[model samples]
Target chain A: MSRAYNFCAGPATLPEPVLQQAREEMLDWRGTGMSVMEMSHRGDEFVEIAETAEKDLRKLAGISDDYAVLFMQGGASSQFATIPLNLLGDKTSADYVNTGIWSKKAIAEAGRYAQVNVVASSEAEGFTSIPDQESWDASADAAYLHYTPNETIGGLEFDFVPETGSVPLVADMSSTLLSRPLDVSRFGLIYAGAQKNIGPSGLVVVIIHRDLLGKARKITPTMMNYQVFADNDSMFNTPATYSWYLAGLVFKWLKGQGGVEVMGEINRRKASKLYGFIDQNDFYANPISPRFRSWMNVPFTLADDALNNAFLEGANERGLLNLKGHRSVGGMRASIYNAMPEAGVDALIDYMTVFAKERG
Target chain B: MSRAYNFCAGPATLPEPVLQQAREEMLDWRGTGMSVMEMSHRGDEFVEIAETAEKDLRKLAGISDDYAVLFMQGGASSQFATIPLNLLGDKTSADYVNTGIWSKKAIAEAGRYAQVNVVASSEAEGFTSIPDQESWDASADAAYLHYTPNETIGGLEFDFVPETGSVPLVADMSSTLLSRPLDVSRFGLIYAGAQKNIGPSGLVVVIIHRDLLGKARKITPTMMNYQVFADNDSMFNTPATYSWYLAGLVFKWLKGQGGVEVMGEINRRKASKLYGFIDQNDFYANPISPRFRSWMNVPFTLADDALNNAFLEGANERGLLNLKGHRSVGGMRASIYNAMPEAGVDALIDYMTVFAKERG
Candidate 1:
């Protein structure tokens, strides 16, 4: 296969133009006579690259000067501990909504440092729906309210941001960021692992309001402390330079495609078409509530579990790949991110239509 | 210029062949129809790539089964904290040697967690030479004895591994790990940032004895805990896939060039010729004692400080890039790591000779 519609969730598909530019510049970046990876981070070339990347990211996301953007490493998992270590300064506990696996993981890591108040939980409902915000057990004394706007594995997404006035709202927007327009002021912090929608696996982008910068616990590792990065412009130590460069390419690609507003409309169409196909076909079904379905990742089950392998094998016979669902979830998931072309989603739906007819 | 001799300390030069292979496979890795960055980290293709890289690193470094090799994120700076967090279980103190800037940084970060005992320091001598081991005051109750085998900025290297009887030895070999053959059995843990001799930045390769695993403190982030990565084979979260792949290519390139013994001989010649030229020329001077001089990073000064920019500009025109030394130490540094060809060293020497003849 030359090039397939990759649905591996993450490290997921990247825009073809980004990959092409990266390949063209792999050995020599703009006549510098060195690959971006080979250039010193402190050098003029990489510094400009880093600065331009940050500037472009701020422009595309409508990030205000009130926020400090950090290009960090160790992915979103590291942020689980880092968030509490930094944010829970004088506070004893933090409020978290257990929407799915990602939210639960964040909650579990935060539990080690602070008393975690479960504001709302959909785990009891097999993570098929997001609990209503009105029913949430509000905590006035909590440092912040944390939630996953979109859960990749569970294929569940929140219809609206929770109302957490005065109390900061933090989100693990790993799978949802850059997919559409976002109000940056709505959250105290937004962290997204770059593999899905950004560029690559090793990098995680953190956009935190400046007020949340200081207050890291003394025990927090210097690299994990947000203030340290904020002070140094994310170069307190050597950052993931290549991953950061690739991410910059991705941000450029996003801007060229008319930024998030245009992406939001296209992504909506892609998700609705696939979800519509799954609903109309008797042989296929998605478990998530309609209002809570994710635009990025669409998970569905066939009429029989025995046909899963055959279904995947046939998909691979065509140019579709990594359609298998998460190991914990034993069905299929098609993650159509910003990079996943609408044609890819259409091809997937067409394949599903044929498969349901043949295997029904 | 198509390509130049990149003398950056790190994100340093990578072998031409490795970069070539990466460029060719950037669009689709082999027949997978997806870039390595696009593959699921748990997928068969990436897992194999990850495992093969580990296997090659182990074979090249002569690592035994007693060690767990981890491909981690956040570079060597993260390990400065991770080493103490994971190793300082019940022990109140750890022993350290202060060789140069890198060692001082490791010591500073470790101070956040434990009683850091500076066993010996060459700072009094301006980091020109390693302190003699016989004068060292190591602690019997120390959790571990740590040292930097090579100080990248100061251009200092240990001629011998510190002898710690029962105490496990830890080494930051970020600039010197695969430059030659190593006795992996000698250390409790060894870590090198991938930017230097490995592949790219944002990835750190850790080799640790199995006995060092399972001793992480309660406060240690799961990502920082050696045991978690050892258990999951470093895929607890998404690893740096693209960097790891490039590293595998570097390892393969090393093997093709006749393994570490051959590299050791070549690296020795590369360093010797550059150092020899500097010593013989009155216009150039390397400050470190000849015995303690680094084989990877050779920091030198000019006859006059005023001519520094002229020297650098001239070198740049000759397609010799990043020869400017660390800002803290205002001179010239030619970091001739394994990827830096002997020919690059020759070219640097040639450029220096012409500049010296004009100005001497």
Candidate 2:
């Protein structure tokens, strides 16, 4: 079947091999005579699937014994509320470093649960760059310091992990997870919605320090309590089994592609190629600072806004789909996630160059 | 491929045709060159799928303009908390009729939000029958009266809708929805988790009276508020798109089979056939009162407990699976939902009769 290079921000493009395997197994998964969707989450078959997915994710993220991996729903947005609900115990305040749209959303949701202190914000500069770490004024007794490593909307990312001293540091790594290697021990928690880099949309992978469990407020639902999920092994309730299964397949695919380390180099190469083309061409511009430009989502605009429709329409006709930018910041966003091969990015760059020459 | 007649109470057996269609469409859904899982929920293609699903569900349920149908996540368990969060506005007390395990859970969760009044309970009666409506002590000024139309574990179902007079009646129809036809106007609200009779485990269907949309507690999450989902047309956040798509197919299949009215008749016949066989055999027994026995989940046991393992082993050898009852109430349960055809139930009865004769 002919396929397109889909650049959707989320519910995004997935590995072709994973989709093929899922199709092959859809009717009778591994000879179980039932679809994965029909298997009881409590059944041994599904339990094994869930356990292996968690194990694979731990391996991929290089998670250690001190961290508990949780598979949850409601995406990264839900974690905006859950992070504070689970961590902000007696402390009435927490520090948040806002890089772009996702971090701001996290701060907004955290405000409902705790006193949100904006330790540093790039919004003053139109979210095109991350503020220097020295500029942050983190509270001494704050519950935790939170930030987003990669903002999907503005295509800005942080190159270094912030040091929070003895306090826990949490990062919403939704868009950049598995794109490169990182020291998992550096942060107290890392949560990622699985649409872009992992597998599917419904599952959110959260790696939290063991010490952060069991401090939820009295009003917290059992489903949202970190301890409840950790104790139950992320089976506090019936999970999104199909998504979990697909995530496992993606994990296996990642392992086959020489794991995250090799994939990181490929990702960097692909990002540099696309970014180089944009920077070299006067007809195209990417406003994000060079040091903080995201490796996954690259938001760029034509020098002439009138050509936006032409670019998208021409790209669609050529089978590059979902290139429209977020309504909050519009132009175009080419999300080159892990599943997106270097060939796909090269194809996109070729199209962008051709469009620029024709319209310039 | 050989398959088993899985009798799991939930995450239960799905129709073979549904599975077949899903398999065929897994790689390229309707010639879109991508699986439904790979599509963006906000895309026009997915929007069409979501709208068609909602429209078909409304047709199957015979829902009217007075009510709004919502496709939500977190299952019925989530709704246990969401109901009180949404309905307990300005009211301190809500009446609960505790019929079985599910109602008890709903009551426990609701207690976190408001004062719960147990109007009637069948725990004293071993949860074998629904308490007579006259025995209820419903509060005159309560926000709503909540009940479970079917108790899956205990296998008791309300044969008649309770009259709430001026007060609104709410029903958790997770196990009984689509098994029968009912007057949509009878209840103020109804919610069903999709695993049993719909498509998958992750999606939950909620139908609420139009007037019940906006009165939520201050602490209610925007995701849990019915009015928010209503306003966004259940796209307030990324929904479980593939599950929603399969549910739409299930609705179409139901329509082709004469919709829920005919499905109700088929369900009753299937239940009676199995129940009749069990009642006639001395070795087999169903403890539920005949008048209140659920058509969806039928719980039963052998005259001797020692034969339980042997019965299950023999059944499995003959392609019967997941017949083990819930751990809370041990024995066996056959959840013959709308997906379980008459032939499967007939095969089950034949196997039971053969096993019973040999055991005796």
Candidate 3:
């Protein structure tokens, strides 16, 4: 079957091989005579899938025994409330950096649970860049410091990890997980919505330090409590089994493509190719600063605004789809997540070049 | 594919046609050139899938426009906490009927958010039967009357809906939703985890009256708020898209099977055939009262305790899988959900009769 180069930001593109395998296994998974959707989460078949996926993810991220990786539901937007509900231990305040929409949402949710201290914010400059660590004024008594590693909407990303001193560092990595290798020990908790780089939309993956467990507030729902999830190994209730299985397939695919390190180099190359092309052409331009521009999500706009609709229409005709930016940010965004091939970026550049030449 | 009669409580058996169709559409849904898993929830393709699923579910359940249907995540267990968080508006207490494990769980979680008055409980008799509604002393000032219409683990079901006077009646139809037809107007709210009769494991369907909207507590998470979900058309966050899509397929298939009314007749026949066989044979017995016995989940115990493992092993050899009962209630359970064919039940009865004759 012919496939299009899809650039949806989250609930985004997945490897064609994974999709094909899922299709082949939809009726009967490996002679189990049941689809993964129909298998009990507690069943041996699904348990192995869940455990192997966890192990593969731990290996890919180089997560140690010191951290517990939780496969949860409700996505990262739910984690905005869940993080504070699980992590705040006697501390009434937490520090947050407002880099873009994601961080802003997290901060707002955390405020409902604790006192939110905005250590740094780039809202004044339209969230184009992550504020420098030296400019941050983190509270010494704060329970944790939260930030969005990559914001899908504005295409802003932090190039460096924040220094939180003794405070636990939390990150919403929804847009950039598994695109590169990173030290999992640097952050106390890392949560991601599994729609961008991961497999599907329903599941969220959370990696929390073992030390951070068992601190959930009394009001936290049983499903929202990370401590309860850790104790039960994320099976406090029936998990998003099929989504978790699909994520396992994605993890297996990533491992086959040579772990996160090799994927990181390829991702960097893809990002540079597209950004380099945009820089060389005056007709197209990216708004975010080069230092903070997201490698996974590239937001751009045509110099001639009137040609935008025609460009997207023509791109659709060429089998390039969902290049529209977030409605909150009116522009074009090509989310080149880990699953996206470098050839997709090359094709986008080729199509953009033709569209500009025809319209300019 | 060589299929087996799967008796797992949940994620339970699904229609073979649904699984086959899912496989066909796994790669390219209606020639969209993108898998349903990859589509953006906000994109037109997925939006239509979500809307159609909701509409089909509303039609199948005979839900009125006066009620809102919410497709949510985290399962029915999460709703145990979320129900009180969303509905305990201006009231300190709510009435709950504890029929079995599911009821106890919901009561425990709701206690974290409100004053739970368990007006009726069958736990003293080891949750073998549903308590009679006439024995229930529901509080007139209570926010809502909560009960599990069918308990999966204990195989207990309410023969009649409880009369709550002014209090809104809320039912957890998790184990039995869409297996039968009922008047939607009788209950203020009805919720079911999709793992049973609906579709998959991750998604939960909540049908709530229009009057119940905008009543969430201050501490309710944005993702957990009913009004937020209803107002946003259940897209308050990235929903369980694939699960929702599969549910739509199930709903479509149910409609093709002449809706819930036809399904209910077939289900009653399947249940009666199995129950009739068990009741007529002295070697097998079901403990629950006949009136309260769950039609979807038929839990039966062998007369001799020594033969339990041997019986399961023999059943497995005969292609009956996951028939072992929930550990909380040790016995054999055949979860003949809406998807379980009458032939599967016949096969199970055939296997059981042979086992009894061989070992008698």
Candidate 4:
């Protein structure tokens, strides 16, 4: 079967090799006589699978001993509520920097449990830029400061990490995670939805500093409480085992491709190639400031809105799928995650060039 | 490859045919040129898959138009929190019947969002029996009455539905769901984690009465709000597509096997045969009261505790695996869900009889 370059923002493109290996092992994983899906979470086989995944993920992210890595379910959207529920102990408030849709969502979920102080927001600037760190109005006794490093919809990214001093810094790194190297020590907590740059949709990776545990409210569900999950090894209940197994395969693939540092270089090159095309062409425009342009999701609009249909149609014909931008921000978006080969970006660029010539 | 009859309480056995089909379709589903995992949740192909799954699931459960069927993430564990958050709007309290581990968990999570009144409890009976529904002390002004129809851990089940009059009844049917037929109209809400009698662990099936909509607390996550899931057709976020798709396939398989009515008869016969073997011999015994013994999960123990390892080893030698009981209450458990063919039960019986003959 000829596979198309899937650009649809996640449940997105996975490495073909991972899919092939999954197919090969679908019936019998390591001759275990059962697919990973059928394994009990407590079984030795699955325990090893979960451990390997956490270990590989830790290695890839350069995580330190001070952090606990958790493989959770319900995606990053769940973390929006979970982070605040687990962290907002006795504290009635937290600081949140609203960079884009994701950060806004985190803030909204946090609002359920705590009083939210909008530290800074890029909405007034159409979410095309990240607010300067100096503009943030952090709360003195806030439980934590939350932010999204990359907004998948607005294609805005933070070029530098924010310093929270004594206050813990939390980030929803769903889009930018695994695309580059990260300084794990800088954040008190980091959570990412696995679909975009990691592995699958159901599993979420959360990296939390060890001290963040045991603060969850009495009412927090065992599954949602970070300490319960950490103590139970994220197997407090049955985990999304198949998704976790697939993520391990993806981690192995990342290791084979020379780890995250090498992946960062490749991602940088691919983003530069595609962004270079958009910047040079008057017919197409990515409004995000160059310094803060996202390396993962690149959202661009055509000079003429009428040409949008024609552009998407042509791209589809060339097997460039899922390029439609988020409905909230109408335009085009190509999410070039770690699994997206440079060739896919080159193909996208070639299509963009051809589409520009015809529409210009 | 030699296959073992996995008696895991959950993330349990699937029909061999379903596993084979999933394996065959792993790389490309119906020549769609993409793995179902790779398909965008909003794409036409995945939408069709999702719709068909919902339709087939509705048919299998005999769900009517008055109840909205929602596919959600976070297993039954999440629903423990979401249910109270949604149903207990202005109400300060709800009635819960603690039947086993799952019900206790549900009660604990609900307590976070509302005042949970334990109307009945089987824990004092060692969780081996379900309290008579007539003896329950349900509050008149409580928002709803909650119970677990079948507890996976203790293998206790309610044989009769409780009478709640105009009060809504919510059942977490995770283990026994679709193993038998039920009058759907009798309950206000029913939810099942898909790992047991359904398909996979990541996806949950929530059936809520139409009248229950719009009652969620303001802070409920959009993904957790049943109304939002109902309104968006469970596409409020990117769902666990592969799990959802597999569940649909299982629903179709169940339909092919003469639907829930016929399947229920088969399940009853299978449970009776296995339970009969254990009861007839003093060496093997199931502690659950006959009426409350779960048809889905049958937890039993040997007359000798020291023989546990030998029993499991001998069982594994004969291709019966995961027979060891849950660590919480150890001995042995044989979860014979709808997917476990009668032959598998016979095999387990034969193995047990042989082991008893040798040990006795």
lDDT of 2 by residue, A1-360 (tens): 467888888888899999889888877778777788888899999999998988888898799989999888777877888888889889899999988878888888888888999999999899999888898899999999999898998999888999899889999988888888989999988998888888777678899999988899887877777898899888877777888899999999998998889999999999999999999999889999999999999999989899899999999888788889999999999999998889889899889889888888
Error of 1 at A354 (Å): 1.0
Tens digits of per-residue lDDT for model 1 on B191-270? 99999999999999999999988999999999999999999999999999999999999999999999999999999999
Model 2's CAPRI class? Answer: medium
Residue-level error in angstroms, candidate 4, position A182? 1.1
In terms of TM-score, the best-performing candidate is: 1
How far off is residue B87 in model 2, in Å? 0.8
lDDT per residue as tens, model 2, B1-360: 476777887888888788888888876777666678778898989999999999998888889989999998888888988899899878899999999999999999999988999999999989998888888898999999999989999899989999999788999998888888889899899999989999888788999999888998877766678998999998877787888998898988889899898999999999999999999999989998899999999999999989899988898787787888888999998989998889889999999988888777
DockQ of 1: 0.90
Go through the candidates in order and give each one's C-alpha lDDT.
0.94, 0.88, 0.90, 0.88
Q: Docking category for candidate 1?
A: high
Write the residue-wise lDDT of candidate 4 on A14-131 in tens digits: 9989999988887777877777888899899999988998999999999988999988988898888888889988888999998888888888778888899999998998888887
Count of backbone clashes, every candidate in sequence: 0, 0, 0, 0
User: What TM-score does each prediction get for chain A alone?
Assistant: 0.99, 0.98, 0.99, 0.98
Would you list the rank order by lDDT, best first?
1, 3, 4, 2
True contacts kept of 2: 0.44
State each model's TM-score restricted to chain B: 0.99, 0.98, 0.98, 0.98
C-alpha displacement of B107 in model 1, angstroms?
A: 0.5
lDDT tens digits, residues A1-360, model 3? 368899999889899989989988888888877888889889899999999999999999899999999999999999999988888889899999998888888988898989999999999999987777888898999999998989888888889988887999999888878999998899999999998888888899999999999999999999998888988989989999999999999999999999999999999999999999999999999988899889999999999778879988998988899998889888899999988898999999999988888887
Which prediction has more favorable DockQ, 1 or 2? Answer: 1
Q: List the residue pairs that clash in candidate 2.
A: none
lDDT of 1 at A83: 97
Give the lDDT of residue A77 in candidate 2.
Answer: 77
